[model samples]
Target: MEAATRMSGYRRHFSDADNEFEEENEAEEEYLDDPGNSSTSIDHVSSGAVINSITSKSSQSKKQSSIQQNSNQTLIKEALLRGQKLATNSREHARLTKSVTYWLAKDSQPEYAIEKPGFKRMLKAFAPRYELPGRNYFSRTAIPTLFSETYDKLKRTFSSTEVSFFSATTDLWTSCAKDPFLSYTVHYITPEWQLRSACLCTHYIVEDHTGENLKESLLEILDEWGLDAEKQVAITTDSGSNIKLACRLLRWTRLSCFGHNLDLAISKGLRDYSIEEVLQVCRQVIAKFSQSWKKTRDLAKSQAENDLPAHKLKTDCTTRWGSTYDMIARISEQQRSICVVLATD
Candidate 1:
């Protein structure tokens, strides 16, 4: 390719002045022997060749530049048309809309596409004619439709006869809003012998927590997904009396969640007086920065000045295993920056 490029340049030189090819070669030889004398000598040999070379290069450059401009303009027009197509609400556009909703859901970005003006502007810049759906459209229509489709797909996927047995895991927890919810997940082995897991459902359980109610909910979910009740392996949950009673009522094998048990063990170990004091100190230190925007900004500034990663402090959750380890590790990594910030404050 390099040799070809050199040959192409040579061709451009010769195409300009056919008479100067011989004189140009002679000038090259003189230039190699005595570079000082060759500049004056070459000017006499073929000034026309030099002039022709410059004219050909400039003309080629202009043509290339013009071609690039036209190509860019064509691309811009095509992209604009594509953006318009996305807005037209055709099947393709619906698919894109569905995909965007899925992205938002997967990333826990509830209304980024709808409520974020910068995001909307980016879409508009690409296609000015297309209109973006409002947040209400996503909340009221798009998300529900997507959920139904995904549920259907999950049902179909798990209904395969190749899956002989499935183990279920259920957790009932209260959200920040103090709403009680039950989450169900299923684990199974494919015919290929690969283990897989999927969240089956999460829904409000407004009724009082009872064994019979839990059993009924579990059976309904299994029947909806076409899972065989007889082929149930085990139901895993925290060692709660209600969950145990539910499993016994359904006649499903019961297994205490290993993760929950481990967390309990770790929590007990961390209850040592020395560990408690240290954790208390760590929490207060992180709380000072994390609870206020100004302190967080100052910490970030300190990190930047100290040539350290601007990682924020993580507050550990009491019920979550390994969270303390993570929080402590981050604090250790950012210790110098934390010191700098403290010193300044």
Candidate 2:
């Protein structure tokens, strides 16, 4: 391409002067030997090749500059669009609209005049604000652009660190109506040794929650953040077969729920094998209490007299895991009394 651009000028220069051929080659050779030659030598040159080369360089430079300008403009436009989507509500839309407006104002064409009342009205109308006046703009906002900028800066800062570690916790549970859900939490630490939110979150939403579906979601999360599962340091989850398999695939350190472990061990070791059987009975007893309004009311009276924890009539699997742990602790501690009550029935 350089040679082609320089060809036209070479043709033009040689057409202008048919002579000075040897001296032109000598001058070109001298310039090659020592690049310190001033523009005076180029001006004196009568060679078409030399003039064409200079013109080619200028043309290439202009083309490069134009390409760079277009790239930057495209990047800003995409950033504005993607960043606005991350805003959660109408208030967020207004704030982001103002930001885009500010960038547009950089064009500074006579299209928007500051002195005009109409322009002032438009600016006032568009500039989204809050009572505190900057929370929307300044709070812990997550924008794709911010992520790009932060990742770039951190890339420079931590490129030398070889052993970056990341971890994730995941679990599966049946929701109300027996629909299943798989949840994952990502955890990572910065090169500075401070904890940072993982680049992944929530569920990867699929048609149905199955083992194959779970494997796909897990792989998708890692792929999105450019994470290698082999690099994961730890994973925490319940003792579900699918979860155990996924962790094994990643070859990470696995941790079972210690509370579940304790329950299993206690049930296995207790002298009164009746405790396990009693729990099965209590499960039905709890259902009886929860079956209708009347039973719930009677249980409430008993709770009131004994100053016991309130009994929620509704049956839901939605309580946090800690709630189950607490219930187990309570039943284990009150086993003697609970056993007597169940036996009398």
Candidate 3:
């Protein structure tokens, strides 16, 4: 009974609205037709005004009602679309947060989670309503929880008897700030014979670079991860005295990194007097031009005049043989430009 009363009230409200609209149109026609408004009648006629004379009042009423109905329909559609957008955004907010956290973790971009310029712009375009997680929030909370969950998953993956044995590689390097870090990478074959490699961990080495210190760190990491040292196949590392001694102390089969050995061999072979002189000259030429903006620009102009693509000379890394080879190769390619720039100077 209450619903029927509400339905009648809605019908009465719409009926009153339609009647008021029709009354306004009738009054406008009457005002235009009045002799007092004769001056405006010419303006109405210029606009091809019907003035409700050609069509009867009922017909005019029906046309106005149709327009009002169309407008109401449009308003309803807009409201529904707005509602759907709000609902979708609410549902997607959680998922987007999780995905962003995971992406930052996987790419080792914890700093990106902080509100930087490009990062904020990206979020504004994709999810304007979402708030970006802070760097501290990710580092202090999100990353640790994510690590715990991932640790459990990896433990389940490696618990199978089929994955009994695994190989690991360790590298210890000093950062630009002179802080030491150690990285561990694990390699294993799945049951389907697919080879997979994963970096298990990278952590700061607060202790000194001694064999005993490294051995203790490795043992602690393995024990934490529940990795069986007896099931380890071999450990590969660069020919660092400390690492070699550590592996020997652990009684694990140690292999010198093949790539490191190859780099050393190439470095030794390139130590001839003639080769050294040529490389020294190339390095000097590159270093002089790189230090001066005018020289670099002049070299670029020379390359353009000679119809050659402008390219920068690579700086050699004394520790890396590959970088030295690349530096020489790039210098040789841009030899004509460098000579022209030097000749002008």
Work out the TM-score per prediction: 0.65, 0.40, 0.73
> Model 1: number of clashes?
0
Worst 10 residues of 2 by lDDT: 130-139
Off by over 4 Å in 2: 1-163, 174-181, 203-216, 247-260, 263-273, 298-345
Pick by lDDT: 1 or 2, better one: 1
Instruction: Provide the overall lDDT of each model, using Cα atoms, as 2-decimal numbers.
Output: 0.83, 0.59, 0.84
CA error at residue 273 for candidate 1, angstroms: 2.5
Residue by residue across 1-345, what tens digits does model 2's lDDT show?
Answer: 999989989998997675577779887788767756655566566566778888999999999999999999999987675554434457765565445444433453342344457755674565423221232343234234455665675444333453376677887766567666667666777666787653344563545655566778788767755666777787777776776776666566898978666655654564376765665564665576555666556555655666667645322232343443455565554444444444545
> Model 1, 1-345: lDDT tens per residue?
999999999998877777687789987787768968767876765888988989999999999999999999999998777665454557756766787688778887867456687887776776465566778888889888988988888788877676778888899998989999889998888988999899988878988889888888888888777888888877889988888899999888888989988888888899999999999999999998877888788889888888889788998997667999898999998998888778877
Q: Where does candidate 2 clash, by residue pair? A: 10-48
Winning candidate number (TM-score)? 3
Residue-wise C-alpha lDDT for candidate 3, range 40-73, written one tens digit per residue: 7787786565655555777888999999999999
TM-score of 3: 0.73
Number of colliding residue pairs in each model = 0, 1, 0
